[model samples]
Target: MLQKKLMLLGGLRYLLPVIEEAHNLGVYVITADYLPNNFAHRYSDEYCNVSIIDKDAVLAKARELKIDGILAHAVDPGVVSAAYVAEKMGLPFQCSYEAACILQDKSLFREFLTEHGFNTPKAKGYENIEDALNDVDYFNWPVIVKPVDSAGSKGVTKVEDKSKLREAIETAISSSYSRHFIIEDFLDKVGAQSSADIFTVDGKLVYATYSDQLFDPDAANPYTPAIEIWPSSMEQKFQDDLTAQLQRLFDLLHVKSGIYNVESRVCSNGKAYIMEVSPRGGGNRIAELQDMATGQNLIQNEIKKALGMPLDNITAPEYKGVWCNYILHSNKQGTLASLEFDQEFQSKYIRDVGLIVKNGDQIVPFTGANSSLGTLFLRFDTREELDSTLNRISDYIHINLR
Candidate 1:
């Protein structure tokens, strides 16, 4: 019984539920990048002419497609070449390649979470902006300068003083591909770090999910995290203290099988600051709204944890429901002429409605999360009918720009 040959790298729009849960568990998906109309390459089955930071042309096309599984769930420039083809085909990845180069080098993941203190958020790593203006008095007024590597929040900024901190560290070190730049110390905190997104196989945590933060009050200055909502509102003793600090950080970075995706934050005085850790998964449409709110396929459990199997025999579907995603930002730089959502104001909690760019497709002003143009995938069954179907679909959508 061996028909699992998966290899997915980059494709915007959260790799469409890892290519529809690895083609509904039969697993033989393939999706390399260089954007050929990327929306998970229209539900991948195969397509690789590579280029997502081509790590040896994606390990020579995953060893000329022997591919028994090696993934890069939702883009981070293809998670270090899908952990270097699961470290040259040994497989079962989620760390190693030196913890995927300390989680894709956000200044070595904030110095490995500030040397294990873990509640980190007073950061500062820079390949010069005069070492962030000599630690800019250790940090104070509205600070955050991101791009120690880059992600959806491409370049991320927010600097309340010193005349905008040298153009926000030269636009976060010129959009760092690794030129480095990170400047934190601005956890004014409301909530934007509920990406637990776990799933380990040999190392056990068997599937888990939680992602929240879908805000946009005019894209809230230097704050980032514009949209994403899932099974979290952030309080269950702060997700059991972020599941005991991410199970002691994947047991001190061993990370057993595939998919890790941790990001953390919770400080209205509760204090829980992980801030980043991405093996992969959760970009937009968060694993397709976590498999439409917990059916738990996660791309055939990341192809049965890259074929080692044993995720306690996969049944998962208790179904409470409350998935949400909404991002329509444009503050100027426009084109898209229409995008209206209401659908009789509530087609039983609408499951999807994407407006993925068209009508000229220019719009790019809302900075972070790569200026998401449209999305809204609510599902309901509780959280007060998903907040009354997101306030009656925000009084029926009307997102026109021009």
Candidate 2:
């Protein structure tokens, strides 16, 4: 029998890899979340109906079970709770509790970065409409408003007109569980944005990698990531500089060991900027893709740390080829009937496709990350081939929303 028990926060299917890894390591796996039918529960040894965002409740459950470690992968709301329980229990922790709280709160994170001399955008946070309205003119013309602590790009609004300020603030607050929001100047990204992961062991950075975050400007929310490509098309020199800056940030935060989701970009000002850095595996199996491209097993390492085991070699990522992950979305709200792709897509471009929704399942209008109904992965032989295909992907495939 596996004696060590690992408690995972949230049973989203994204954690299936972590669950499988733990099972293989002979570690008892348990899942917790408000949803009982999260599918991943079927693979867990036991399940608990606790709200992942409620730290005290989850910590109580963890104590009752006497779990050896706690992890919240790819779920933003669960990160703070998992870190809190680990800190209180004296178990292996990703970072100090104080640092984890700052990383989880968008406003605090931005403040920390700005104070530390990192390349970031001017930003402000507010909890109410009046306060945001009063400070609206403080920024440039075009701006972005979003929930301070929300994930999956929910409640993010692009406001180019002052008349839309109140509406944008309301939308962001509605999406935020904390009822807090942040407003920042909309940066003109030099290339595509970057959404990737960095791993550190004992306050020493071991792995740092990034990808080009592609988006569907025609989608309900233009800011939501549509596709992300590994081996970013960014100039190699820019990537190198960003990597160095992140290592310094990791050390400043005293991050000992954990997987972090980082978003950055080269802006129109001809400088690379670090937009966001959160301590958790990102949504959409981003780290999983990196694991596939490189030989590192980040999923296994995350679980291993919670169990107080030595981490796997995260030395450096070795890209075998160019790869991309696409989020399948629908432009209309209706039942999903089918996703049809041209013969060329099936025969030449797409490596694999996965539909999170079943035939006849409800498909919501493409809005944020949550609206994605499926995933598409691609492997291209050359950078030029990858760029040309992404630029004209929609012409080759279509999702039918009945």
Candidate 3:
């Protein structure tokens, strides 16, 4: 039997599980990116030097690698490239290359949603800061400005006044690789936003789950979510409706087998809207958390889909507990900080914690997913326990910084 070959675009840490699993299954995994020191490369069978964002270059490299399949899970910059390579090489793809292009670009996505009559925010894309500033007066207050192609909330901001539009636009443009940005109506969060991970097999959704995405008002970036609680608080009817809408969207776009990380909301307007639909796994190990809660390995299914292996794990999710993943970060820059929890805290509720930072390590202010300190997984027996614990988190959790 030949060792199956797999190519992973972009060497992000989140790709580690895919590489390890492939290795365990006796598959030869090749990791690719311009950076030689990206941590994921340390675990791959081979490392290839190539820019993941350049689709043509990546396709050429993939063909040269003679790999069986390709994936860009948890790496937004590599999604289009992965799709392009797979489409060109007659391998499996998450969606059509054209659909990938529409999904990857914020401007294009918003336009498509509106044109297709989806529940969407009023948004406009701009390449000219001056033009955006001139048109800023047209939008309502508290509009969100963000880079069109960037993810992890790198350059997302909410502006309350016209005075801040130029600054926000500059920040977004600086953070964007393509120097394009979008300004959109900011829907008032009614309860909590929803960010979820769902799986599809053979152009059909197989499993779906969402979480109530919570934010910290005092974080360096107020828009960045501080935590996520699984089994969303949204009414079951809305969840079902959102699932139908998402399935419709995929069907219309002809999305194929893989995982989708979606950001959406059931807002103050009493309408559910999808803010983003990226055909890849999410940051913060959302799929991993789902696996932990449901005893199903979406990572395996995602890898199998991309690599043309038999789909064995696709099934309706059977949840076990109410879980949450804390997006740990500091509101200020610091060094030599201590994260301590009460003695009873761990025994009572804390399931697992991975503090990515160490004592005396320089910590950046909470800005986006890139600045996340680590992930803390917690499980509770009931919704009340989960809510109470999260509501008074500072009581049991301490962050002492110098």
Off by over 4 Å in 3: none
Candidate 1: which stretches are off by over 4 Å?
A: 1-92, 97-99, 107-129, 132-144, 147-155, 158-163, 166-217, 222-257, 260-277, 283-285, 288-290, 293-296, 299-324, 327-343, 352-394, 397-402
**TM per model?**
0.31, 0.96, 0.97
Clashes of each: 1, 0, 1
Q: Scored by Cα lDDT, where does model 1 land?
A: 0.72
Model 3, 75-99: lDDT tens digits are 9999999988889999998898999
What does candidate 2's lDDT look like per residue over 159-212, in tens digits? 999999999999999999899999998898888899998788887878888898
* Stretch of 10 with least lDDT, candidate 3: 17-26
lDDT of 1 at 92: 75
User: Which parts of model 2 are misplaced by more than 4 Å?
Assistant: none
Alpha carbon lDDT of residue 149, candidate 1?
Answer: 75
- What are the candidates' C-alpha RMSDs? 20.1, 1.5, 1.4
